[model samples]
Target chain A: MKARVTVTLKPGVLDPQGAAIAQALGGLGFTGVQGVRQGKLIEIDLAEGDAATARAEVEAMCEKLLANTVIETYAVEIA
Target chain B: MKARVTVTLKPGVLDPQGAAIAQALGGLGFTGVQGVRQGKLIEIDLAEGDAATARAEVEAMCEKLLANTVIETYAVEIA
Candidate 1:
């Protein structure tokens, strides 16, 4: 099974990288870029057999180390 | 409008970061963790009114800066 994990910052968190990106866009002449928030995408290829099992395991991984729950939220997709 | 951009390393590209992540997971005692690839997720908030226009502009941003086209591929989603 293959799983895709998306980890994004919670709202109201300070994102200096996002701010820098938005500013850079303006400098690049790309108008209308108001805000930019950056996050992480992790793809895991597993030898596991069942989708349910893989999803459950990956969720554990997210909770353990893949994501920082304090400032980030994560979603998992199994394929 | 809001746009979500996912940037991932192309297949066959060497990803030292991914390898390091997998190794770290092993140290954390998470078994069955294999083939970990890390990527980026960027969310952009736009003042633009039209979804199509925002998507188009965000695509340009990805092509020019958000992604390194030589080794990474990017996908943009507008909401």
Candidate 2:
């Protein structure tokens, strides 16, 4: 089984890296870019299991260490 | 309009960061974790435009600066 966890900054959280990226894009002539937010994607390969179980396991992983709950949010996908 | 670019290490590339994450998970007692790969998610907010246009623009951004084409691959999503 494979599970993917997408971890993103929570709304209203300041993202300095994202700001830097947006500024870089503007400097490079990509003028239409308004804002940018950066996040993480973690792909985990697991032992054989159903989607439901895999999702639960990954979500637990997210809560424990994959995400910084105070300023970040996470979503899990299984395949 | 919003677009997302997912940048990941290419197959066969060594990912020390990912290895470190897996090891950290093991230390934290997430026993079922077999393999782990890490990537980046970049979200861009743009002026009103069609999804196709937004996707194309983001793809260009990925190719130019978001991804290291030699060792990374990227996918774009628009909403």
Q: Rate the local accuracy (lDDT) of all candidates.
A: 0.92, 0.91
| Candidate 2 interface RMSD (Å) | 1.1
Query: What DockQ values do the models have?
Result: 0.86, 0.84
Question: Which residue pairs clash within candidate 2?
Answer: none
Model 1: runs farther than 4 Å from truth?
A: none
Q: Which numbered prediction scores highest in TM-score against the true structure?
A: 2
Query: In model 1, what is the error at residue A45, expressed in angstroms?
Result: 0.6
lDDT of 1 by residue, B1-79 (tens): 9999999999999999999889988898777877899999999999998989889999999988899999999999999
lDDT of 2 by residue, B17-43 (tens): 899899998999888889999999999
Q: Give the number of the best model, judged by DockQ.
A: 1
Worst 10 residues of 1 chain B by lDDT: B25-34
Candidate 2 CAPRI category: high
